[model samples]
Target: MRRQRPIRLQHGTSLHAIVLATAMTFSGASALQAREAGSAETSDTQVRLPENAEIQLAPVLVEGQERSAGQYTATVFTGAEIEDLGLFNSEDVLRMTPGVNINSSGGTNLSSVFIRGVGSMYLSDVTDFMVPMVIDGAPINARHISLGTLDVDRMEILKGPQGTLSGPWGLAGAVDITTRKPTRTFEGYGRAEYGEQGQALLEAAIGGPLTDTLSGRLAVRYSQSEHWVTNDADGAPMANPSNFALRGQIFWDGKQGTTALVTVEHEDVNALPNLLVLMPYGRKPSVDLTPGLYDDVGKSLNRYALEVNHDLASSRITSISSYMNASNMEIAAYDRKIMQAQSGYPSEFWNQDNGRESFFTQDLRLSSLPGDTITWAAGLFFQHMDASYDTPRNTYGYTSPRFRDFKSNVYAIYGDVTYPVTSALRLTLGLRQNWSSTDYDASFWRGGVGSFDSRAMSESATTGRAMLSYDLTPGTVLHARYARGFAPGGYNMYAAQIADGEPFGGATNDMIEIGFASESEDKTFALTGAAYVNWVSNNHLLAYDSGTYVSSVVNADTRSQGFELQGRWRVGGGLELAAGLSYVDARITSSVFGPSDGDILSGNLVPDVSPWSALVSASYETALPPFLGLSSPMLKSIASYSYVGPRPANPQNSLDLAAYHKLDIHVGVAQDKTEIYVRASNLLDDMYDLYGYAVPAANMAYGGMARGRTFVAGISHRF
Candidate 1:
């Protein structure tokens, strides 16, 4: 079907300016309040309110803690806050997190998450360079981490090296998501929504008692959307995406000290590849070209997990076991007609990639109960994964087929201890030892002949952390820490093009950081800030060799330093405000494959590393007067703005991405058991590039475009 052009809304420029100015003004007011409150010396007991008039706020927890008083440098978002922001998926949630960036080439399943300018530059069945993602205590693959957050209880983003606690694959950071558990009371909610471009959504969840000692919960969601882009060649829709997911969970509270929980989930996704528009000399095209063909890419996943906990006299023991299976298939036009348009190629080529992967993991931990002077935890972890990829291509009467198989095993032991040296001072120490091995096998067939080769490699590393924290005053704390992280290396599947039995070496990072956190006596204002410097040795870098149509992984040295600030304020009346700002300086210190062998590229900005980013948001809620013989209803509205600075697109720092800004707004009304809302995103309908890659041989370049203005309306009911 032909897609219609979006209507450009007016008054966006004025609204944007107003939002920025208002945020700045409120920020200044909050800072002044902080200063006034800090002038007087007060005991920590003075911050507590009277028992009768005390107001309870949502608790701040990070991945299983009752509160995040002084554990680590992190950010926590509750489910209610996520819903208020209208962020229902992983992509949107990560984009709003501080110091994080996400880029999707063409499909949500093919997205990459970068933290502190560290992530994989290419996607493959055997690559594991991105930030690790954990859902319900089970680790998930990077390609399959775009699951919906509809039923999440809380999300915790731990910044910097977490190797000692999360094992490998956390060299940059880690994201842990906890799903809502079954409730003892009977309750459920259902919602439906309609939006532009033929978008429709349906979601429902229910949880209640099934038996005396057993409770169960089930949730399902489905969504479909028409293409937002138009194809000029045939005047048809360019891309359409849809997905369905279902989850079931059961909980058993057995004896006094025993508890168990089990969960199973399945998800399926089908979508068209991202729209690719050719650009020459970094200029947008007046008109988009037509693709020679179109095909759908599909992915399916199944996951299962079991967790058990037993309380001892002075400690608790826990165990977690998980399994996952996933498959993906794609068939599409490889050239997208860019070759024909720019290089006069006779015809476009076709390509296919079919792959599958399986994962098994187990973790055991024992932790001492809370103590007056000391607390400690120790754990053992194990994981095994296998993956296979097959690729077939036909270009101008030449056919080539390739296949690769990969297997990996990981083992680790870690421990951490915290002790209070004084009433206001605390110290912590942690260490981890990891051992990993990988085996890779590949084969290629051409002219009715094939050859095969196999290679294996193993590595070991020890990483640790040391920290000190002190309370400056009531509701204020200052901390400093030193940490180390590691990421295991592996072989490139395209063994035919590289040296025999050669593999990339593991990478390591060392960091030193200082930070502070403070909250107002009334809990109406909060602020957290951090500054850190990191040096990485043997940094893994992916480079494309245009001459050979192959990609290679290499090691180099790099450095990154940055500071981040986040704040929240609850002004008088019904107004609330939040804001975040980050600045980073990341560069390559040395590399061997530069303009010449052993050339130094010191001071060159790293690819995809934005130097500056900021976010500001406001929300208001109040009761409305009675109308139409109905009781008072509540009205709520929220607005948010985000800015991302420009960055280098390649290693040479030749091509650059332009800075961009986005705005989102939501308004709703609620009465008793019913609620209605309307949401608008990208209010300005701004057009910008999310990512760009060059095809030098075809004298062409293509990129992914940011989404334009979109609107949605929805209503829901609760019992």
Candidate 2:
């Protein structure tokens, strides 16, 4: 892991010129619909209220949703239901939300993403990195997006500590994505799918009217799968020959109001698999150990964005600009006795790795357009980043050469205001000011293991937020919030192996949230609940050495509490349901080694947290009229179930982890354009292991293997 390059935050555009002239005069307002003459009756409605009444909500809309760790934020899957769940990235739709967690070592290569439990394991620099990653609307820099799950039109996961409007590193949450625009009529769509072990996929999209003011959209996707780890170390069967994506967009409706939008994207990924440990702890998994499998890992990413909108009358102006570049080269190696037995895993080392990232972002906003009882918004944000990490340790037998540089720059100014005072109470205020600078450089092996410099360091902070909402009626809502979020600190390249030699610092947090929500009507039953607590300071931890697993990055202080519940239901007619639940109580209250320090490793437990997690979904759709070739619409069915618990991979938590479950099924058939599909994931052949590690006596177990149930089919067509 290595990075060093950052300094960006560009804001200008006459302060978003009244939201780019009110998005060019409302850009047709999606076809300006407001005719209620004889009730032509379209679709889309909500209002049920009765789960103990007193709710008045509706004033939150973005793309992408599922955020709760205190500060309520919800949108629960959309973007065409996350591309119909044929997930290929973005941790497979953020592991189904609620508390979020993902640690991988599968055929898709190696994956990592965690929330609530805090992530960036075994240190090497990457302390929450503000968790900011925005596509479509810019802002993306976190070592060139190791996050996946593409083909989106929505994905908003804005949990706690978002630092007023997504600034200040977003603290511990922020995953917003929106892709799918540019449509002037001539619509189009396509899809081809196949599932089980030899997964395959193809996707397409088209736009319309390239004139009348300009409008365009293009999308492409291709995927492949195989490799279920039948290697036995070298028996053959490690697949992932391809995965690709290409996207394009164009929109301009200029005239006096003005509006311009542009976007571009590309992605390529290839992989071999490894890491499926799960022995005693989770009970089953770990078919056979294959030390250091994953012979190849490649990643490529490039993105561009430009947005401008202006509309003044009561206020509305927006501006966003972005750029991203990413690179990954990994040739792995494992099995140091499967990580020295375990007990804190981390063995000597092996390598041939190179990671690079480049990012830039700009955001500007001005708001007002929903009543006048007092509502406001102000914004300015900038980011710049450049990263690098190179590893080397072996050759002749294959590979070595290491280097790392981490550079950064961020600037921000934010504002928020809301007031109602009586009509059922409502008051919200927010503020944010952040300035940061960091520079880190390192060189080794090919560079003769000689360089290491830090020098440049600058930090400024200011954050605030207050909330209170009570609207006991028009739906239902009860909310309470008090906020102070922070996460910005860096420098840790293993922090000199456990801090002894001292070299690693940066970490912070403080948050509080309370919530409640309810809904009915077309939304079919909705409920939300929240409870949270967190206080972390200078907490950049990653100790270890007990059995000599070799790990370091210290600066400890921690506290966490949690509760969250998300929902959606229909349960009738064609059936529809969605659910999420999470509970956590992370600990270590105070550390630098205290609470009876066992070799200075306190209360333990907190490695890859998972106090509890859950998800359940059911779907169904039907339409048939035209016959044979299916002139118009047709079949759709989906099923899902996921559960995770039992976590403790280290921190001397003794040993824990023994809960797992998964089941997925999908079936599709459509018309009016084209479609075809089939899927079955981990059905019954339920041997599981999400991830694990061990060292010392050399214990190794990584399992979550299920390529056992397989079958596939595909087809697609469009204008």
The list of candidate 2 runs beyond 4 A from truth reads 1-70, 75-90, 95-125, 132-156, 159-235, 239-351, 354-390, 394-400, 403-420, 429-441, 447-456, 466-518, 521-574, 577-679, 682-719
Please give the distance, in angstroms, between residue 272's alpha carbon in candidate 2 and its true position after superposition: 6.2
Strongest candidate by TM-score = 1
Worst 10 residues of 2 by lDDT: 29-38
User: What tens-digit string does per-residue lDDT give for candidate 2 at 582-697?
Assistant: 88877665535421213324455566677887766555555657877666666655655666676765444544445555555556676644556666664444444555544323
Predicted structure with the largest lDDT when compared to the true one = 1
Mind sharing the TM-score for model 1?
0.88
Error of 1 at 3 (Å): 42
- Ten contiguous residues minimizing lDDT sum, candidate 1: 31-40
lDDT, candidates in the order shown: 0.66, 0.56
Q: Please estimate how well model 2 matches the true structure, expressed as its whole-model Cα lDDT.
A: 0.56
RMSD (Cα, Å) for all candidates, in order, is 6.8, 23.5
